[model samples]
Target: MSTTTTVVDIAPVAEVQKLSLRAADPSESKPEGKAPEQEYRYAHLLPHFSEDRYPPLEPYEHVDPGHRALQHPNPRSFLDTAERVIEITPQLGTEVRGINLAELDSDGRDQLALEVARRGLMVFRDQGDFINRGPDFYLQWGRHYGRLHIHPTSGHPRGYPELHLVYRDGKQSFNFEVDDSITTTVWHSDVSYELQPPGLTTFFLLTAPPTGGDTLFTSQVSALKKLSPQFVAFLKTLKAVHSGVEQAEFSRNGRRGGTVRRDPVEHVHPVVRRHPVTGDEALYVNRQFTRRIVGLKREESEAILRLLYDHIDKSADNQARVRWEPNTIVLWDNRVTAHSANVDFRHLPDARHGARITPQAERPIPALEGLDLSA
Candidate 1:
């Protein structure tokens, strides 16, 4: 399997590195005698969210008395401090308690990188960044991991080119022709059409509804593991066409602003991918971006894709849900998990908005257990 270099493969190093980050003023007031770090602060925006929107609540603070929480083990990989991690489930999802997502020191940044790998997604509740300042902190969080990824279609935030917009107005619908029950709500790994897709995608939920704006997650590792050995071996022999254009957009309801590139970028990837950092194998197919299996009849490809989609998405046991709170941050590895943000609140009164940060792309490398990934 020879690899070809595409426009997506080569990123502008000089252009990306030269990008400036918004920082604080030397004359700005600080509490007591503390000093400011070199990174960006709340210089660009104001605290606009009303207090009633999202009351910053602590973990178990809002819970009823005598309601016990799940006891979880300390986080395993890439953690600078296990003391902070509170695992939500054995499969995936966790909250790295008692830390400010809006700001992180050098050591804190390193711990975050490890934490993202250990727990497929790390949730930070009641973050100051999402509440007050615009996407400045979110941009810093992205650069802390790697070179920030700029979306070709999604527009950037004001003064912050690194941050992408992730907003959904409940007043609108993708396909008004069908029932709200039949939505384009299929689970997907973010931007899988790119040969080198986003390594990590972070979402800072600035405004969540009074009820029902939860996002679902499933471990692709768990999905692949569910299949038999014979099935796994057979899948490794196939490749799939992944495109984020018209076909994929329909699955997503439709693109924001209804802008579509006539010739959208596309790529081919293996059914199995090895994590660049963790080296774990994951099922790479998703109903949203993956179009068809290569070298197969259209009928054969659709049948297989449908089967794989059901296996990964339909199983609740392999999944976890994050009920959103205003100022909540959820960062997940695109290499290992598939996620779907629920639109159950579409007709409801509340509106949702968030700033997204995606680190540099990780070229998908195929691997399987007991087999050499690079042949």
Candidate 2:
């Protein structure tokens, strides 16, 4: 069969009717999968727990076997190492230098690992080239302890299925616009919201905004030191309910284009958690996901939680703010320090982005193993 050749022009016509169309009316686009930012209205919900109403928090009175109270006064000696270790905060956190992490010999790596276990945190700055190696570098450093954390659902990096990305996006992706501009607010250790929280969080920042985006770290041990004697005693006897349900619920169904449903896991951790490595006790309550005091009445729980939250949030001399330099890697003991990122740079189109490797801890321990709480 012979077919006739035909030409079809796909180009637009040169000239047609000159119809004037009014500019398409502009419409505001609400970000997808995010709730409208609402003002926090819980200030009035706090209960006042004065000394007359509630019992005072007493000092710890118990002592463990083979450990004596006030005998070893210097806890800093636990972190001393031959390698260069510089204190970043008066109470906690240290930066180690004069060693190449990329090429650490087996013995050198082992020594560094021991120091990290003791110091709570170890920082390396001006290592732009080292971070370029990406997850491999983290694996190299973390292999001795454990593998990296794989998040159950959200807060993971894009195109890096193997590596968890801790970033915030405006619309379709995970959004937290309602709260403060910072990414993480309320002083907390990484993944403490989970039933089994990660042990250590190692973050390497490849890019940071010119201004803002500083990470503030404070020692929970120092926080415990500042608390009134009565509060410490009260916390020792209480347990707080921590749940990942709130964030999991939001991620799964609360917003549009949400992820799969995951049940909230609840675990009760001590209000004062002791460090398994360094043997220092720290105030462990955080404002974000800690729901209630397990045995207390609702009113009593509210009263004490308000006090503890305020105590940790205050800006004090013991707090240290690290202005991130490009390619700086910070490894913090999730068991010891509470950190919040300064989010002043949210207005910028491109802000801070990095890869984080969090390893799960074997178990949580008290800072002072032998301290008596019943006294």
Candidate 3:
């Protein structure tokens, strides 16, 4: 693979020709077995409440959790203790083995934090120990990173407001149905509309389907690096407006029983953001939340955003797909990655339920060039 960091031509003729000439793989069809009807494993954990019962939380500032990793006395010590640390891809995604997240010492936690910041995502399997410890431990572990963010609209489990429930039943259909077509994939950095967006996000699978229900992640750093430097420079000068209006509307329309704990928010973030720990540039605008580029006409912003979205979606080299299983956890730095849930098993009766713990981080900062270190 080319290790050059400099900008290259976008989709050269040779590359196009090579892609066109690629041999097609033989199609193997497997019969879809009937999935047994099942109830959500952690349904008991969910709280019963009316939509108007949740009191609104006041907006507040948050400190970036990555700061602790930066100040750690020994940031790389966890790698020594792990049985193996496999980098899944050259750009992003890591799988660490032989370490239980529940028993992590302060140093181990700090090191893990550093590793997550360096690698865009980390995968841990057989996390039964951590999962069995329950939501109290989960919330505490997340709080160690930063202030836990209570989602404005999502359904959370009872007694644990910090954990956002990602649950779906067989009876419900997705709202994206347009003329009998359902759009399942929506790529986004979680809640980018917030004044302080999520930093490190933890998603723990309680019950996964027999097959399917994988999540897609793409490295924004790699996405930004692929563009020409001139284009990158132009993007760095711009900011995009991210709004939670659509999400709030979805909640209010009885999606989650008309739950709206807090009002929807809107904020402008840089088109290119600088990761606080790695100092890498990442293309920060996302399709779900980002509405328009600041200071641009509606059509102009749409055109530019459409181009960037296509770049992100078409970059196969920069993406990773994570297959889920029960007792599995995937943690990622929300600042540098955009993720989408694969709802391939939507038609099936098998349930895919998970809980996410997200810690709000510092305000989005632009990845500007020509910094004066002397100051």
Candidate 4:
């Protein structure tokens, strides 16, 4: 595939160089000093982090997590450092214990990435130690994997552009028509509209209501496998268009108060994408961003997408749920999973707030049969 020149403004050369050097030498990737402690008292304020103008972007390339995992001399064994790794379900999530994410070396990080690639999501509990290490340490840990992605319109803390704030106050009335369940409209991978979409996302819950704020993760790999062979084959031959126009418009004229720095984008991606590390096929379209299948008529695309979406929604065996607690961190690979939050806690007195750091990975690769993807 030909490489597209980058809009240097989106990802600066110096920034890319720094992340590259860090990836090459994991020992040097650790942050120098602990960041001053910050209180989570400001959960109610929705602060938009945006630049004055965002230059238009063209497609660019980067080494994806799968390729990077393969480069690790021993990617599979890094999990041996964990005290215990428990599979949450036959197909979807894993709960890892006794591993401090802030302390993982390069090899450990690589293996963790590999594990998330293979498993849809990994949950680590009682992560207050890592969470308290502050944004500086957290950001550095994310950068070690890849160049961090700045969310086009999400609220960020005052100085940190890399930290996307997930703040919710229970008092705000419902903004849209009631769906009866949030999962109906919210199941999605993070930012699928980007040329190079997000790979691994770190979501750390800092505060939570005592109950009712759980996230549901669906394994696209498993979702695809459950289909009949003929259907899967047909899906492989198709591409879908994912768009960011709704999100951009929301940022500009909706509740976000015009926080968009990067222009909203749209791209065509394989309906079935190949996992970079595991060499597995996954259903990639989500209800949130995926607009339509490229070659189909409007009705045909809607029918097909609706079928896939319903499959993902009803495949109970392919899903896993993570109940949240303060200081719990869930790391998920967007390449293989789609997730949604249970907004049930939104009506509770307590606020639901968290910090998310998503690192961009390679452009989606079509899992075309007979293609030499080994390169």
Query: TM-score: which candidate is best?
Result: 3
Which candidate comes out best when scored by lDDT?
3
Give each prediction's root-mean-square deviation over alpha carbons.
15.0, 16.6, 13.2, 11.7
Give the Cα error of residue 209 in candidate 3, in Å.
Answer: 0.5
Runs with alpha carbons beyond 4 Å of true place in candidate 2: 1-85, 155-162, 168-184, 253-257, 260-262, 366-375
What is the per-residue lDDT of model 3 for residues 1-375, given as tens digits with 9 covering 90 to 100? 011101112112112221111212224343479432222235444432234444544556665545676777777776676788888899889987777888888767777777888889999876778887888988889987888888877666666678887754344432222224366667899989887898888887666666777899999999999999999988888888899998889867765545678888788888899987778889998888999988889999999999999998888899998987556789999999998888777776655557788988877878875422110
Per-residue lDDT for 196 in model 1?
70
lDDT of 1 by residue, 186-209 (tens): 788877876577766778654455
In order of appearance, the predictions have TM-scores of 0.71, 0.69, 0.83, 0.82
Runs in model 3 with CA error above 4 Å?
1-41, 47-61, 71-74, 173-182, 369-375
Superposed model 1: Cα runs more than 4 Å off: 1-84, 129-133, 159-161, 173-181, 247-255, 260-263, 368-375
Every candidate's lDDT: 0.61, 0.54, 0.74, 0.73
lDDT of 4 by residue, 209-324 (tens): 66786889999999999999999989998888888888888767745445678888888888999877788899999988999888788999999999999999889999999987
Q: Give candidate 3's error at residue 227 in angstroms.
A: 0.6
1-375, model 2: which lDDT tens digit per residue? Answer: 001101111011111111110112225455799644322121111111111111221223221211221234542333343267678766766776544466655544444444554555678665655565555556655654454444544433333333554432121223322363333455667657554566566776544445666788877778788878876886776767776676666655543224422345666677788755456677777876678887789999999999878877885755777777555678776766787766666665443445667766644443335433221
Better TM-score candidate (2, 4): 4
Model 1 CA lDDT for position 48 = 19
How high a TM-score does candidate 4 get? 0.82
